[model samples]
Target: MQPEDLVRDHTIYACVTGSRAFGLATDDSDTDRRGVYVAPTALFWRFDKPPAHVDGPLPEQFSWELERFCELALRANPNILECLHSPLVEHADATGRELLALREAFLSRRAYESFTGYALGQRRKLDADLRTRGAPRWKHAMHLLRLLISARDLLRTGRLTVDVGAEREGLLAVKRGEVPWPR
Candidate 1:
C-alpha cells in the first residue's frame, strides 16, 4: 500500500504537537500534526514493507507505523515519548486508545538520560550561537529551558506531561526576549 494510504486509512492515533501541544503557541505558530498508523499485518509478509514513516499529505504533518512508534517509545526517545503524552489528541481509534493506555509503560529511569542528552545537544547549539553572535536564538533557548523543566518533572514524578501548564508565561517571556538571560 502507498504511504499516504497508511496514514489516511490506517491511522490509529493522531495529535497536535510542537508548540500547540506544549501550550506555547503564538498566534503565528503552525499546527504540527503527528500520528501512528498500523499497516495491515498481512502486508509485512511481502518484501517491501510499508514505510516506517510518512512525511505528509498535509503540511507540517507526519506519522509512524505503530510498531516503529512503540519501539522508539520503548527506547526512551524523547520526541516519541512526548508525542505519546501530547494533550491535544485529535483522533484515537480502539487500538489508539489501547496505545494511550500503555503510555506509562514507556517511561523509565532511562528518560533522565534521554531528555538530558537531547537538551544538552540543543543547549550546545544555542551556546555556539551565543559565543559567536553575542546572543542565543531566544526561541531555541526557551525550548531548551522548557525541555529541562519537563525532564526534571518527569524524572521526579515518573510521568510525562507535554504541556507546559503554569510555566507558560515565563517561557513565553523567554521566547519573546522579554526575560534577561544568564540571570
Candidate 2:
C-alpha cells in the first residue's frame, strides 16, 4: 500500500507535537503532528517490507511504524518519549490505546543519557551558530534549554511530561529573543 494509505488506513495513534504541544505556542507557531501506524503483518512478509516511516500526506506531519516506534521508545529516544506524553492526542484506536498504556514501560533511567545527549548535540549546533553568525538561532536555543530542563525534571521525578507548564512564558520569551544568550 502507498504511504498515505498506510497513514489513512493503518495509523493507530497520532498527536500534535512541537511548540503547540509543549504549551509554548505563539500565534505563529506551526501545528506539528506525529503518529504511529501499524502496517499489516502480511506487508512484512514481502520482499519490499514496509516503510519504517512516512512523511506528510499533510505538511508538518510524520509517522513511524508500530514496531519502530516502540523500539525507539524502549531506547529512551527523547522525541518518541515526548510523542507518547503529548496531551493533544488526535487519534487512538485499540492498538493506540495499548501503546499509550505502555508509556511507562517505555521510560527508564536511560532517559538521563538519551535526553542529555540530544540536548548536548543541539547545544553544539547552537554554539557553532553563535561563533559563525554572531548569534545563535534563538528559537533553537530556547528549545534546547527546554529539553535540558525536561530531562532534568524527568530524572528527578521519574515522570515524562511534554508541556512546559509554568515555564511557558519564560520559554516563549526566550523564543522571542527577549532573553540574552550567555556572555
Best by TM-score: 2
In the order shown, the candidates' Cα RMSDs to the true structure are: 1.5, 0.9
Candidate 2 on 1-183: residue-level lDDT in tens?
898899989999999999888999888889999999999989999999899999988999999999899889989999999999999999999999999998988889889899989888888988899889988888888878899989988988889889999999898888788988884
Instruction: Note the Cα lDDT for every prediction shown.
Output: 0.91, 0.91
- Per-residue alpha-carbon lDDT of model 1 for 24-68, expressed as tens digits? 999999999999999999999998888999999899999999989
TM-score for all models, in order of appearance: 0.94, 0.97
Lowest-sum lDDT 10-residue window in model 1: 174-183
Candidate 2: worst-modelled 10 consecutive residues by lDDT: 174-183
After superposition, the stretches of candidate 2 with alpha carbons farther than 4 Å from their true spots are: none
**Where does model 1 exceed 4 Å of error?**
none
Give the Å error, residue 72, model 2.
0.6
